[model samples]
Target: MIDIQFRREDSNIMSVEMSGHAEAGPYGYDIVCAAVSALSIGTVNSLSEIAEIPVEVVSANDSGGYLKFTLPTDLTQKQMETGQILMKSLYLSLKSTEEEYNEYLRINSLDGK
Candidate 1:
């Protein structure tokens, strides 16, 4: 199963970490994995290319799968807004995926509590 964690600081999404394969279908044919990957990679690209925000990020595919993004400590107001929008889109996409594919994916509430 894929495990996803989203972190929030002061009511703002501060980071997201996802790891593992969905194992929902054959490796190359897993829609769950595809959807998750698109949301994560797309949002990360948007944050860097469109939002133009510097982010602490890491990704790996060697063992299972992994991706993480941490918001910069200091951001201009516009940068913050754009990054938030991108991350929020990710959040919503993952939520929708989880709703339809709960057995193949999971969203762990690893948000700073």
Candidate 2:
């Protein structure tokens, strides 16, 4: 299964970490993996190109299972707003996927509580 963890601070997303394989299908034909990858990479692109914010991204160098990004703390007000929108969109998309593929995907939130 794919495990995704979203971290938040002050009610704003601070970082995200995704790991594990969805193995719902063959290696090249896992729709669950594809959906999560597309949503995540698209969100990263939007954050950099559309929101104009710099995020710290890390991925497994020789593997296919892990991805993570940390939002910068020094974003401008407008950037912060746009980033939140993009992040929320990602969360919703992932949530929808989780609802359909509960056996293969999971989403969790860490609010520093």
Candidate 3:
């Protein structure tokens, strides 16, 4: 399971954390890596292009399977809305990837019989 939490320090700054287990198969780590890469890139692009706000990937850990983001501190209301959209997109992407990986494992197990 993948969990994402978003915390707003003020109207302009926010923090996001993503944590989950990677145990589906050999490709589990790959899936997680891809998700993290996509999220990091997507968040930076979204904030810069859509929100015009600066964002950074504060820390990332593959062994422990966690990622964190620090949002800009001068965001406007529109930028905040954009941040919410980006966060939701990242959360959904992680969740759907996990579900897909789990389903792949199930199918692989069945085929191995």
Candidate 4:
């Protein structure tokens, strides 16, 4: 399972963290990549109309299977609200995709069930 967390540090900054477990191999990498890609897209879309914010991946540990990102900038109330929704949607999508992919790999690994 993957846990994604988003927190508003202040009116001008937000942070996101993602961690999860999956089959140790290519499957794990695929899941992480998918989640990161979706996150990047969601962030860009959410902040496009707002000011150009600085996004930094604070840390990412493959061994521990976790990633943290920080985004900083002043944004309007409307933008903040929209960003919250977008972030939630992105996280859910990533979690769902990871589960689905892991299930597929599990089934494929079976000999002949």
Winner by TM-score: 2
Q: CA RMSD for every model? A: 1.4, 1.1, 9.5, 9.8
lDDT of 4 by residue, 61-107 (tens): 54755666665556566656766665556556655664666542211
Instruction: Work out how many backbone clashes candidate 4 has.
Output: 0
The true-versus-predicted C-alpha distance at residue 110 of model 2, in Å, is 5.1
Specify the highest-lDDT model's number. 2
1-113 per-residue lDDT for model 2 (tens digits): 99999999888987889999999999889999999999999999999999999889999979879999989999999999999999999999999999999999988765633
- List where candidate 4 sits over 4 angstroms from the true fold: 1-3, 8-13, 20-24, 27-32, 40-51, 61-65, 71-74, 98-113
How many clashes in each structure? Answer: 0, 0, 0, 0
TM-score of each: 0.93, 0.96, 0.56, 0.47
The residue-by-residue lDDT of candidate 1 on 1-113, one tens digit each, is 99999999887898999988899889789999999988888898899999998888888857648999998969999999988888888998899999999998999984654
- Candidate 1 vs candidate 3, TM-score winner: 1
Quantify how close model 4 is to the true structure by its C-alpha RMSD in Å. Answer: 9.8
What's the CA error at residue 75 for candidate 4, in Å? 2.4
As a TM-score, model 2 comes out at 0.96
Q: On lDDT, who's better, 3 or 4? A: 3
